[model samples]
Target chain A: MAINWFKYSSPASFYSLAGKMIPLFAAAAVILLIMGLYIGFFIAPTDFQQGEAYRIIFIHVPAAWMSMFLYVVMACWAGFGLAFNTRLSSMMATAIAPTGAMFTFLALWTGSLWGKPMWGTWWVWDARLTSELILLFLYIGFMSLQAAIDDPRRADKAGAIIALVGVVNIPIIYFSVQWWNTLHQGASVSVNQAPAMASTMLMGMLIMVFASWMYSIAVILKRVRIIILERESHTTWVAELQKDGVA
Target chain B: MKPRHKKLAMIVAGVAALGVASVLVLDAFQSNLVFFFTPTQVAAKEVPIGKSFRIGGLVTEGSVQREDTSTTVYFSVTDTSHTIPVVYTGILPDLFKEGKGVVAQGKMSDRGIFKADEVLAKHDENYMPPEAAEALERAAKAQKASLSE
Candidate 1:
């Protein structure tokens, strides 16, 4: 009898599917990023005053946006796992943790580089910067907590609770400039209002954001496949796949 | 109750409480979050004098002056259209240079000079820390290429 596809949520089925999706997403990520970079650097018009220093926005803003976005995504998966007792969901959250942390680190590091030229400082304890730093720590804490624990199920539950609590910071990070007299600038592109920047610059930034989103999906999918393999090593499906030369 | 489960619960609660406390503390101090404004913004009277804040722009050419003590440096930050003079005393970041982006945190004096408590030098994306010379070279090349094109 053929097994139901949805039952593959049992880890064995999701593993094969994740493996199939990784290469496709990776190819899309590479293509979109290269195209986005070309438009950002070569084709975009230079700022009248800031000149090339403004180019840093293409990478900085997108990475910053993605860092926050990926955290929320991780939290959602964790929440689902906690609520439904779904093993696949928690594994997906675990898979996304490292990449999310990397993006957060990248955002902070690149923001510092951009900030030095624009703000004249390598670092500050300002609202936006401070909150972002906290996000990084949260990511680290989640990963460490998961690794330090011997039992995977207990680790997932603990990590899920932490992730849920960390969600409070996400809104604070996004609204820091508006809610407080922050050192950081207000939003340049709001959902309801027109963008403060030139059209070309906005286009470039948006394209880069899409590219980053694609890249995250690609990396997370790849990581999820490895996680499934390790977690399901004792399963009969894994044994069958290995015997079939498909592992 | 299992001892192990109790310990895990306590740890999780402790972390969550810490996170909540920090957010509250940060929120309480939110009023002090001052951001740097460009010389153009200052010129437009967007920044109030005698109010502690930050000002950021490029160091105007030939505007840097060193006090006899060698620790104090005075310079004007400009965005071509506007200029704000700044006074700072301390070892500046290695990346700080003339005609480069700078942000100084302090109050604008009655005399219109920005008296800075701190100064920060901005670096490029490709730059690694503690290597100002290489970043300078790259900046120069980028500027030259942009101007030529």
Candidate 2:
């Protein structure tokens, strides 16, 4: 039998399904994070140069990657919602925004912590950092713009516009190091070139990245279910579910 | 046209307009976006005098100089194509070393010396910053071609 994936596009169906998956992903995220941190700290050799301080890359790089990746995913969902007028897609976009912003802030904070010991400064107006900062603003703007609107549909439309507009910054952030003479170091792990890191370090970083990915999905799914309940509260199904004490 | 078509058209137009506007804004900010200049660019006098900027490259081999009691130190940064002498008065990061990548933030003097306010070393030992690595690769290729000829 084929799985009717499209059926879950409706908010009600996805709400229950995501509720089932959240615990699994949350557990995976926690386990992977612990393993990644352990491997990063204990198993990875001290950088002949940076010593133990380089281990911050395990968290910093993953957070930065997720920030950028989530923005694109958010924009894609927002765009889909705008085009198809789907409530669930808009909810997904909204749900992902706060998490994306959190990761972006984490990336910046960890970068500053790493920088102080290594780069000798807490912060600089480097292209990568600046664009990432702008991304934080975009997320805040999207959420605030939505909150300011009373009607859910209007808020979604407005949020979609902001999300689409901010999509330009994603490429800027990714390519900033390459396009500018930024103090920020270039990527160690890239697609075309071999990783400029030890295998164990690379493995740990990858695991952390996966862990962050799982965490984002689980959190966003949980948030979207709440969004659906709030927006669909007036519907008969929601009332019936509430009466049954399951909503 | 239908109401849905009208909304779709509005979004398309709006995104297009926003895209064009951002492109213009970013183009205006292009020069300012350069995080640092290479030693080669400094040598070519592309950098302005007394204007603070950053220069990034490898610390040229055996070029670090330090005073006996003073915190002042001098080093030369190189991309193999050109080198800029940098004078800085402070403790350098632990990673700062000869033959390693570095970026110094300062100004170029009229006499061609760089007065550095801050000296930052690259991230790690195994990591040659992408810009520094790219420059080295270019220099190596040039050397190979010259030797072959």
Candidate 3:
């Protein structure tokens, strides 16, 4: 017997399912956050070069990673929505934008904080930095373009086009150091080489990365549930949920 | 194929075409996208004379110099294959040490020197505790001594 995975593609069912799953993800996020913070601040040793100032990587690296990862995820959802004309897929894509933008902003902010002391400047127009900045702009562009359109279907289609087009920048950002003589350092944790970092520092960074992932999933799920309720407000199921005070 | 399948195929084709277009575009704009030039690039006279640019590489070991009473500092950046002399007047960043990565933005002077307006430390991705770093240094020293003996 095969399970029908498409059943949850319905907004009414997904909304309730999301509501049920939110607390679990939220709890995992909180737990991982605490553990990650403890490892980052307490267990990790001072950097031999940057000293304690380098501890900011715990937040900076994870936020940067999440920003790029979330954009790909958002674009994929938007593309699927556009291709299949699925209402739930479009709503999910819409719900992911704000969170993706938030992570992008966080990545930029935390990066500057790390850069000011280590690089002797708060900002530079290096290839990696510029590409990442363009990513932030792309996220904003997607959201604003969608909001500018009054019709939800048209907004989804337009956003999907922009999202798919912007996917090229993702590879550019990831490979900027290798492709050019960039001011930004190459990745510490790339697949082709052994990590350039110590084991403990690497562990802390990885833990924080997992924490960010959990946090993003929880927040996106909660946001999608609200979006579902708003989009399906006229449906009988939503009306019953509102009447029963379960919404 | 169904209408949905047709739509999916269309989107995939559009995305693939867009990807190929972007690759070509990026290739054409590759030179402009480079943040800095290496010492090898600059040494080959490929860089335009009298034009300001950035050169990034490792700060040559034992090449740093500073005046006792002046703010001016001199250093050499090397990519192992080539080296470029750099001069700056501002205070250096804390991480700007000899044998470390650096990027200096400036123009080549008439006397073949890089007059930097801004100097920034370009650190590697390595992050280790001081103890681990000291251990590595000690091991390197030991290997050097054995080789000499």
Q: CA lDDT, every prediction?
A: 0.82, 0.89, 0.90
Ranking by TM-score: 3, 2, 1
TM-score of candidate 2 versus the correct structure, residues matched by position: 0.85
- The DockQ value obtained for model 1 is 0.12
TM-score of 3: 0.90
Per-residue accuracy of model 2 over A145-217 as CA lDDT, tens digit each: 9999999999999999999999989999998877776788888888898888778888899999999999999
lDDT of 3 by residue, A160-210 (tens): 999999998999899888887788888999888999999999998998899
Task: Rank all candidate structures by their DockQ, best first, as comma-separated numbers.
Answer: 3, 2, 1
Instruction: Choose 2 or 3, whichever is better by DockQ.
Output: 3
Clashing pairs in model 1? A116-B122, A117-B122, A120-B103, A120-B120, A120-B121
lDDT of 1 by residue, A14-101 (tens): 7777778878878888888898899889887766445577788899889889889999999999999999999899998998899889
Give the TM-score of each candidate: 0.70, 0.85, 0.90
Winning model by lDDT: 3
Predicted complex 3: CAPRI docking category: medium
Residue A32 accuracy (lDDT) in model 2: 95
Deviation (Å) of A135 in candidate 1: 0.5
